[model samples]
Target: MGLLDGILGQVAGNPEIANLAERIGLSPEQVTAAIAALGAAHTQPGDTVAGAADSTGLSPDVLQQILTHLGGEGALGRLGALLGGAEGADGSGGLGSMLGGLFGKA
Candidate 1:
């Protein structure tokens, strides 16, 4: 599989994709494409759903459904983590560090 496909698989497994595809009335492949498009659009400034819809040709409403299914705004952060954008220079997993900080760990 390609890098993006690998990331997608890690982010949303087959069962999740199948459920989302069925709910959105889109094929699993299309759902995957939409997820990728949303991830790409999220890197930019402004409305993610609109940008994803423009790129993927899947209406904003559908993209919104996908976004909500993927866990709303927090999904983008999770995607970024999967894409390696969440690692610190010290190699401490970003989310792990944040949670550790919350618990007063050194």
Candidate 2:
């Protein structure tokens, strides 16, 4: 799998990110960059989506759509938990929870 495939796999199922990117007319690179920016924002406390839009030159609406497609609020929680090394209720560091931690939701 590609780098994005691996990274995004933490937030979504395989091929889901690719499908969302295609639907939103964004390159996989752009999407990946935005996701990275979002993760950074979680730590730095900046405008996560806006920073991504600025960097990727994608409209905020498009980025919002991508986030929504990825499961929105629940997705963010998962990302935060994942990044923060917080264990899920099952006592394992599941991908979604790990990602939630990354986004500072944990």
lDDT of 1 by residue, 8-53 (tens): 6543545567777898799888888888899888989889999999
Evaluated against the true structure, the overall lDDT of model 2 is 0.60
lDDT of 1 at 25: 97
Worst 10 residues of 1 by lDDT: 97-106
Q: Per-residue lDDT of 20-85 in model 2, one digit per residue for the tens?
A: 668888766666666665555544556666776776777888877766665664565566555555
Candidate 2 Cα deviation (angstroms), residue 100: 12
Q: Each candidate: how many clashes?
A: 0, 20
Give the alpha-carbon lDDT of every model.
0.71, 0.60
Measured with C-alpha atoms, the lDDT of residue 1 in candidate 2 is: 29
- Candidate 1, number of clashes: 0
